[model samples]
Target: MYLHLTGTHLRLLGSMHLFPTTSRRTPPWIAEAYDWADTLVFESDPPTILPLLSANEQGSADRLRPFLPPDAWQHLNAVWPAGGSLAPLAGLRPWAAMIVAPTLFQQVVEGVEPRLLRSALTQGKPYQYLETAEEVAASLDTIPLDAIGAALALLMTDLAEPQRTLERMHAAWLEGDLPAIHRIALESPMFNLPGIREAILDARNRAWAARLTSLLARPERTLVVVGALHLCGPNNLLDCLAHPFEPVPDDAA
Candidate 1:
């Protein structure tokens, strides 16, 4: 995933937000990319630690108890036991819950971006992000509550389904299978929801491409890491960029 530019040093890495548990350490290829780059770019800063929700909080299960029907509430509690690891989700907004749930459910390790971010923090390697917090919030808000509810319901009812899809995506990414990556990303529940593709993936890809366009003008060798999904399907980040990017080839040496 190292993007090559003559007379400039810029690498684009498609990152997995959560790595399979089997991958406990940074892959050598990723380490090489980090070693070569003087600067780094990411989708966003690591989010702030989530605070425990108070009883009066709108998104808390305490408030949701009265709003959802008895059977619905029962199902929620049953699916995510109060003492279970998933219990914290009950305190998050639907959007936040949707994002965190898969990672919580998975047997995973710190992923590509997080691993790099940690190293950057330890070494004091400077970095920046494509979008601000508000822009991310605005994009996430476009996903209807019903869409989030249905997606969550899918996760609850058929736990194996999401796990299978995640496995497929991870495998595709590992193998550098672009078509499979695009297919899996487009077919994922959240992306498949109505109008969500345009709002979440397409818009953000365009915006990120614009930012990278600006960043490429600078002198430093930089590494850019984002979700693997954003680099494929229609209107991918590279395609949206003002100029095309070329990938560095591995030699027989």
Candidate 2:
């Protein structure tokens, strides 16, 4: 079964059931998928690539410094000194910086993926990754620095807001609302950048579709989880798979 952010939120909500319920919520399909799967395939990088990327990212920091506007550069340096290897804003390529900014924002707001990964471990389900960190990083690197700069500028502004965008996304995921997910995804600032849609979404979707096809040839029931955005629109993974896609059941949530 192919799951998306719903799986992430479900895993999180499932894990949290051990503690206080609080405000956590999950769609029914996520639970259904988790129960049915014999193996779990995570749409993530291999474990070993993160540390290597961190080391290499700092070396590109000086290269990116000249591209930031004077005010943006000053603000970034003030917030994150260049001397720090993992300084959030400094010493990173534009694409890497763009990726990091939203990640940090999501951290503050809380995310489903971390909790979901924890649940997978606790369940002792065998897990596999879809790509290496090097491959993922290389794809992001294909994005032009100018495009990344534009994305970063918009991101900085969005960060100042109350993050209504994230709230909408989370709500949609919890409700298994695909239309809302597609709408929000299409309207994202990232789509405004040239080649980004193709590089990050379409191309990756095609690659994943091929991988998933190979997995399907095996007899073992597998649960595939990826970002919610990759499941919508033309040439999306679901479409590329040539499967008859169905909308989430109204009662599923």
Candidate 3:
């Protein structure tokens, strides 16, 4: 799957399975797309981490305390427990930890792309990446630290709204509703920060679009899995590709 660097959509896609419930059922087009593919392509380089948290880093959680809403703060403490250090989050890069903490507080499961990678390996499907981990990190670095902090504060202060938005986005994805996905992308908080939107989405989309075109030149059937967000909006990867692949209807599966 062409994954967004953050693995957000990875979780959404990976959770989809058809048998039990639609909540996580694999969207019909995704399953159908994969069924004929012999190769898988990812959007980023291999994953790695930078030291954003460490046991010795004092006031880690304290820095965020003032920004967190009462309920969010309560959830944070519930995860880390009071009087305990922020050691559990020490291994993650600061940005990663920031992204993860809110999801954990909200009890959302993520990292579906990594699981897909493992499955591809086990099934002996060849795979390639469009960008390296270093490149992805560098793009993230372009977003000012203050912006990151502000985004985190927004996440903490109004948790419910974001969660609801995500639910809607997930539903749109499952239905293969590209227009809905595009609408959400335009409204997403990331778009509020022009620098970040350019770095993380636009630039990467352009690069991936080029790579995807090259891959399409090959004779083998390829399954391209990417973050749903990348496929939406004007100038997005989907728009950039010479041949657009439409999603099959859920009922058509």
How do the predictions measure up, each by TM-score? 0.82, 0.77, 0.69
Query: Compared with the true structure, what per-residue lDDT tens digits does model 2 show for residues 1-253?
Result: 2333322221111111111123355545566666666777777743564454452633564456555676765655555535444565544655656655554444242244455567789999777877777778777667776676666666666664324555666667666666787787666667657877777778888887777766655565666667777776777777776644344343543
lDDT tens per residue, model 1, 1-253: 5566544566788877876676566656778778888989999765532332221233443433444455654665565646644465466556666665555466776788878888999999999988877677667656666676666555566556666777788888777777798888766776777656777788899888777777777788888888888878888887897465676555400
The TM-score, computed over Cα atoms with residue i paired to residue i, of candidate 3 is: 0.69
Candidate order (lDDT)? 1, 2, 3
> How much is the lDDT of residue 100 in candidate 3?
55
lDDT of 1: 0.69
Superposed Cα RMSD, model 2: 5.6
lDDT of 1 at 39: 87
Better of 1 and 3 by TM-score: 1
Candidate 2, 229: how far from true, in Å? Answer: 0.3
Candidate 2, pairs of clashing residues: 61-91
User: What lDDT score belongs to each candidate, Candidate 1 first?
Assistant: 0.69, 0.58, 0.54
Q: Candidate 3 residues 138-165, lDDT tens each?
A: 6655555455555665665666655566
